[model samples]
Target: MTDAELPEDLARLWRRPTGSGSRLGRPAGLDVERVVRTAVAMADAHGLAGVTLPKIGETLGVTGMSLYRYVGSKDELLILMGDSAFAVEYIDAGAAGSWNEGLQRWARGLWRAYQEHRWLADLPTSSPPRGPNAMAWMDAGLRAMRPLPLDRMTKVGILTLVSGYVNTSARMAQQLEQGWRQSGGVDPALAAQRYGREMARLVTPDRYPDAAELFSSGTFDTAAAPATATPVDPAEANFIFGLEVLIRGIEATTASAALDTH
Candidate 1:
């Protein structure tokens, strides 16, 4: 479906209480879950900076104070919502063939989660994830890497790298997607055409024979094809590149330890 017909990403973030108790002194059917659900939708629509309990309540047709009966302060709701979003994702430990594959899967899953809840990246890093759902996702990542030869510190390092990759990549992708959407979606092919035209007029074909030939070969067209906010895994290639260097370093360290022992 076109963007016009697509489902509102905001619906999952907030909704009004279903019954009449909202008119009473107490929120009749409201609870923390409903509050969080609504808050997520509001944030999804307007960004994390936009979601205040009062604003959420207004969206829900309830007074802001009434929401406190179920959810604590706005800070409390944010913690719960971040953890809840993390809770919905889990790694399939059995599906992958090795630690690297498992790590890649874990990275991809977390990436998808962040994309779905773009505000997730904005979750207060100071809190450090106390909620059960958040801890569970952390545990799942640990479990996926449990069989690797790496020690606890290495596990932490690898997971850190994976998490960093997901968060950083998703944030970049989100920014690009948002900017493109705001500009009616950039065309990758148009980028290639623009580059080719600009270069042909500036550089002499004789002086830059190799560059000119490369441009003429249409390789830029192929490379730019997936640059239009495609969700394809450029990460796989990047991960493989980084992994090779990391693995080689680890092996060198391991070999030195073996030699020292011998």
Candidate 2:
């Protein structure tokens, strides 16, 4: 469809091909892709809040108002940034041996994208993603679930759940790492154990029985003092643990669906 047919916000997203088109009388080197890339870089180095049109223009050696010819406003630029951040080439989800393997690969691919662009987790989901790259991500997830007996909505639901899990998990990890760096960059295991130890003092069984039990179980202590140095990084280990749990849930749902059809 042409840009004219879509809503204003969505039209802006699908309007110009990346780096291919420029407005008349625009600067020699500046284009949509370059501007978005510059903003993405700013977010990567500083943060999402650090990316302003004026800052990007200054980096590109132009006036901020001149950028209006390309992107309409800051909100529109954010939409571009959200789409641009996920510009990684996704693995073909249907190629895997099973839906389980296919989805794991898809989820990991998305996770890697988030890791590369930490600011991505901070971008608010103003509306359903309509950009080419964003739609491609959803398409990949649906492809992975194509073998399942479930219907379209079920597949979409699974994708939404997995996507939310990866985004929130990445955000938490990023926040924790930043906090750790700010607080002397202690070992993560040590950090976990210290938090547990401190919580143990304030939390009581009367008010928080489950939490008290968990704190008293010495789980954090074991993590802090593993028997041998393991090759797996703790952050990745936690990620895989949660990912496998979601995969198992999806597999169970598929199994149920198959049984129902029999």
Candidate 3:
């Protein structure tokens, strides 16, 4: 579509080459893609705060204002980075053996996307998907649920739930990891033990019975576990566990509908 046909953000986001190639008199070897690529690299290394137009321009050996030729502003560059970060190879949802399996793969893909680009969790949410890659991911999610007996709206709702869950879980995980690093990089097992001990000390059974019981259960004693204990990463283990529970809940809720349709 022509730039005129799309909103200002999308027009810049979905800009295409005009066969004529680089604009006349513009510097050779510099273009929108290069500018965006450089910006994404900066964000990946130093985060969104470090990705000013001036920094991008300096990285590309040009003046800060020169970047205006490619991106309208830092906001526009963020939109581009948000889209480019999802450039991971798309997994066709149709290839799955079952709807749940397809959705599981889709959700895991999103989690991996968050893991790879932690800054995505920090970006402002764009509802209705504002870019091509974002729209493609949404389409993949819908395709994954094609086998569901639910109506389109229900399917959309499910997709939204799954997407929201992945984003929330991934964001929390990133924050926790960041906190862990900031606190002198203590071992996770030791951290868990310390947390458990502190909770046990601070929590009174009469005041908070349920949480007190949990703290008393020795569940958080990771350091005392055997050497052969499961080596799985706790963050990944929790994510997978929560995802499975969510999928099971979805399956149970839709089972009756599937039966009725048959």
Candidate 4:
């Protein structure tokens, strides 16, 4: 195909060139998947900034400039990497039994995916997803919500909400975990005690009565806090709580829509 006629991301992902002449001078052994995979490994090891075309080429035992023959640009490579990284098996919503169950499974699966590939949360969001795997994931979520009495836009909105939540939560957790590790891996109880003492000194009851109450309640005492009252891992607990709230909102909205139609 001519440069102007080159297929976009989705089409480019699956389309094969017509002949050896279409190789764009790419090395005989190099192909698109290997190029994308090499970039992914580089990014996983050293973040997005480390994934230069040169580095990818070096990793694959080729000159870095030659990588351009296979992948057009760094931006395009990133899009491919993200699509490849998140390519998941389609979730069987039928097996999930109910809309709620299906959506819950879908959301949790997405959460797990973000956790497993924390770098995904760092990807640039300048454009909407258009890659094959990205579309497949979107299709899976829509299928999960198919039984609901909701419009197409509403279903898309729900998927957006869930994806945003998962990405933000995963990013925050990854940052916090990195910070914790950087701080010499301090004992959680000791860190909590020090944090409580600092807060008590800085936040007096006269200036912050609510803060004082929380401090006095020993809510910051990681070891002493009741399991039933607070999660052992607050980050994870927050994600679960937020996901449930989103699901409930979807259910309520769909139920209301159904009633209005009757």
Each model's Cα RMSD = 10.4, 2.9, 3.0, 3.4
For residues 162-195, write the lDDT of model 2, one tens digit per residue. Answer: 9899998899888888999999999887888998
Name the 10 consecutive residues with the lowest summed lDDT in model 4.
12-21
Q: 2 or 4: which has the higher lDDT?
A: 2
Off by over 4 Å in 1: 1-25, 192-219, 225-262
State which candidate has the highest lDDT: 2
Give the TM-scores of the predictions, in the order they appear: 0.67, 0.89, 0.88, 0.85
Q: lDDT tens string, model 4, 1-262? A: 5634646444446544523236555667778888988887777788878878877777888998777667667777878888888857534445778888888888787777776666889988867767777878888888877888778988898888888988898898888778878989976556777788778778888989998887776677754454685547666777898889988987888888899999
Q: What residue runs in model 2 are displaced by over 4 Å at the alpha carbon? A: 1-3, 15-24, 90-94, 226-231
Candidate with more favorable, higher lDDT: 2 or 3: 2
Backbone Cα, N, C clashes tallied per candidate: 5, 0, 0, 0
Q: Output the better candidate (1/3) by lDDT.
A: 3
Give Cα distance to truth, residue 53, candidate 3, Å: 0.6
RMSD in Å for model 2? 2.9
Query: CA lDDT of 146 in candidate 4?
Result: 80
Computed on alpha carbons, the lDDT of every model, listed in order, comes to: 0.66, 0.83, 0.81, 0.76
